[model samples]
Target: MKLAVIGLGMASKPHLAALKLLADQIEVVGLYSRSESRRAAMAAETGWPAFDSLQAVANSDAQVVIVITPPNARAELVQTLGAAGKAILMEKPVERDLARAKALVETCEGFGVPLGIVLQHRYRAGAEALADLMASGRAGKVLMARVSLPWWRDQGYYDTPGRGTLDMDGGGVLITQAIHVLDLMLSLAGPVAEVMALTGKTPLHQMETEDFAAAGLRFENGAVGSVVATTAAYPGGAETLELECTHVALKLEAGALTLHWRNGQTETVGEVTGTGGGGDPMDFPCDWHRDLITDFAARVQAGQAPRVSGRDALRVHRLIDAIERSARTRAIAQVEAEA
Candidate 1:
């Protein structure tokens, strides 16, 4: 499958490396970036054609287009490719604003195009195994879930122009940093029914977005959850994500899977650390990206619906949107009907 990955950000490097593993199956035909120097550098490194325009990239031999641009430009880019009749794999948050997110979904629907959001956390081994446990009734019942993260980002991180801006990066902690785990939270429990959140800028960071965030979420399955994510935590080592259910507790330090459950009626569950990547949430199954791309390509080949279609991405975006709205109004917001 020929693919084009638009945007040369931090996440793009892994995708490029992953494609190297499946060199026989996938070929990156095009690369797109705004930074002339970085774009030239990426092209020189990959030995791929560099295009000054996204439309040219869309029209190239790349049957699959991966939009890794900022959330603000994602919708327009997706819509553009959809117009060109291309299958798309986009980075998270769908769009910078809810209206644009909804518009992208609607446009894709009208065009009958295939879209996949890069919520790669859903592709993690730990998340998949735990989801299986919960679904198989081995976890008894989900009584509660807690998604917490105290990740660190240096002051230099937000120094970039669009680093923490609402118009470009979307929301700060939850939308940008914690969204993968949060999406995994929703994927584990169920779609969020409502969310009441508080977000603000506590530290004098280099940007205007919030540095601290906390939220209370209610899952539609009657499971209650709490979320706390911040960049203000000092001496940041590893961010933590713990999900507790009726009789099971699954914890991931960074992204590795760990499970603790009641052995007997009152017995304590044993301790063991799971394999797979634990630091970068983006590093999951080696073939996860390939699986995602192949799935989209297969759908495009068969003229069928994609597993992570644009509508699916819109649902994730809705949760992100509701989180931001919930923060502003300091009230719970509902997830809208899927289009």
Candidate 2:
């Protein structure tokens, strides 16, 4: 399979690196970026042809296009690709807004193109194993879940123009950093039925969106959940998801998983790594991205939906939308029912 890449920003490096790992399955045939300097730099570095426009990318022989642009700037490019019948694999959170995300999904569906979201955490070894355990009833029913994303971003990080803004990066902690954990929570505990949340800008950073967020969740499966996310935690900390099930308690800290069963047995699965916590957001391993990209290539070739399809990712967005609504109203907000 031949592929093209758009947006040469922070996420571009990781995606490109992962694509390189999958060179046996897919080849990057073209590249695009609004910034001529970035395109030139990438071309000079990789010797790949950089297209001048989205139309050029769509017109290329590349069968799939990887979109690593900001959440707010994806609709137009994705619509163009979908209309051209090119398969698309986009970065996480789909879009800055739920409506536009939905519209993008519809456009892809209408064009009969497969759309995948870059929720690569779902492909992590620990997460996949935990999800399988939950599905197999080996862990019994999940009673509750706790997610903590104690990430830190200095004032200078948000001071960058378009950073942490609703127009560009979308919402703060919840939508940006915590969406991965939130998506994993949904995968393990099922859909959130309702949410009540509160958000505010922390003293550590000056930004239009919240630097800290806490939410109460009621999952459709009767499992309760709590989410605490912040970029204000000094020096930051590991992002963890603790699921208390009837038979066992599972804690996924960073990329590793630990299981504590009712029989007083404890076992750890997978490896622990930095995962960009307390560091630059883009600083993390590309293994999971490689897995997801590999899956995307296979799905594209098979004419099937990718593991993390657009519709699969919209659930996370809907939960975030509900959390935002709850924060605004200071009341419980029902999650939007999916069609």
Candidate 3:
């Protein structure tokens, strides 16, 4: 399979690395970025050709296209690819708004094309192991869970004019960072049925969106959860995404999954890292992108849906949308409408 990557940002780097990792089965032939310098930089990193326009990029020999574009432009780009008859792997928060997400989903489904969203956390070894444990009933009833992402983003990070603006980024830390943890939370604790949330913005940052978001959640499986995500923390430690169940507490700390169980079992665990990016950020204990791309390629080759399907992405998207509404109304919001 040949792949093409659109957008050259911090996130796209991992995708490029993953493509290299999957070289045995796939090759990334070309890259597309609006920024000429970014295209040059990526071309230097990976010896792939870079193009300036989406049309030229789409017309390349790649059978698969991975879009890591901004939220606002994703739907249109996906639609264009859909019309062009190209398979796509898109980056998440499918859109900054729910309506656009729905339209994009409809467009893909209408075209009967294979469409996927990059919720790569689900592909991590620790996540897979814990998910197996949950399915095996080792986690018991899963009474409650909490997800906290208190990472720091200096004002300079959002100093750019468009940073953190609702129209661009969609929302703040909850939408950007916590959404990954939220997907994991949903997987572990089951789907959230309802939520009541409060969002806040401090003068510590000069951005149009909220810097903090707190939500109270009731899961469909009778589990309760609380989420507090913020980009306002100072002197941040590791970018932490932690979860606790009735019988197990799991966290990804310093790039390892730390599991603490009721019977006094506490240890860091993960699966064998496969042949993938071999250094620094790539060599980190967990290479989410490599595993995800490999798995997706395998599934696509076998004519099966990806483990993380587009519909699953839609569910998580709905939950995020509900959280936003609950925060805006300062009232409980149901994740699903009444049957």
Candidate 4:
């Protein structure tokens, strides 16, 4: 299979690394960015062909296109590539908000293209193991879910133009940093019926969007949970999702999954790994990205939906919308699954 990657920004680093690992499985022929210098630098760095323009890449022989542009730069790219019948795997948040995000998905679907979002956290080994456990019924019914994403980012991190802004990154911690764990939480114990949240920016960082959030949720499955997502913590740590189920209690911190059974037996799957929660955002390994990219390539080859399809990713977007609404109205917002 032939693939291409667009937008030569910092986010492309992990994807490029993943592509390097999967080089034997597929050929990455074109890399594109608006800036000629960026294209030259990346081409020189990775030894991959750089496209003259996005249109050139779309018009090329690439079967899968990875879109790694910022949140504000997705709609037009998706439109162009979709019209060219390219399968797109994009980075998270879809767009700054839900409406544009939906349009991107619908555009690709309407054009009969496979669309996948890069919410790589769910691809962590421990997360996949837990998903399997729940599917096998050994995890039983979930009664409660508790999540915390205590992450730290220096002001310099936010100092990057549009780093923590509504127009560029789409809100702050909830949409950017914690969307990974929130999506995984919804995947495990969600379809949250309602959400009551408080979102605000702390004095620690000068940013337009919320850097901290505390929310209470009621899942449609009768499970209740609380969430604390913030970049205000001095030193960021791994995000955690602890589920208390009917038969077993599960704790998934970073990449490790642990189970506490009713009969006093405890078991663990996978091991704790760096989550890039600290001052340096790109501190973690590229293995998760590797697995996700490999999976997407195989699925695209098979004419099947990628694991994290655009429609499936909209689930978290909807929940984030509800959270923002609840924070504004000071009311418990109902999560409209279709909204």
TM-score of each: 0.87, 0.98, 0.89, 0.98
Candidate 3 residues 54-160, lDDT tens each? 88866777777888988887876787787777778888777787777777877987877677888877777777777787799876777777777666677876876
**lDDT rank, highest first?**
4, 2, 3, 1
Q: Scored by Cα lDDT, where does model 4 land? A: 0.91
Cα misplacement distance, residue 199 of candidate 3 (Å)? 0.7
> Which residue pairs does candidate 4 place in steric collision?
none
Q: Which digits, one per residue and each the tens of the lDDT, describe model 2 over residues 203-266?
A: 7888999998999999998889999999999888889999999999999988899999999999
Better candidate by lDDT, 2 or 4: 4
By TM-score rank, best first, the candidates go 4, 2, 3, 1
Each model's lDDT: 0.72, 0.89, 0.75, 0.91
Go through the candidates in order and give the clash count of each. 0, 0, 0, 0
Candidate 3 colliding pairs = none
How displaced is residue 118 in candidate 1, in Å? 0.4
Task: Please give the range of 10 consecutive residues that has the lowest summed lDDT in model 1.
Answer: 267-276
Model 4: per-residue Cα lDDT over 251-310, one tens digit each: 999999999998899999988988879988888889999999899999998988889999
lDDT of 1 by residue, 1-339 (tens): 788888998767667776777678777887898887888999999887788888788778787888888887776677688888878888777776678777877787777777778776665555566667778987776778787666666676777678878888876877787777777776667787888888888654667888788888887888888888777665344555677777767776654667776664422222233212223434334455666666666777787877666666666677777878888887778866555
- By lDDT, is 1 or 4 better? 4
Off by over 4 Å in 1: 264-291, 302-304, 337-339
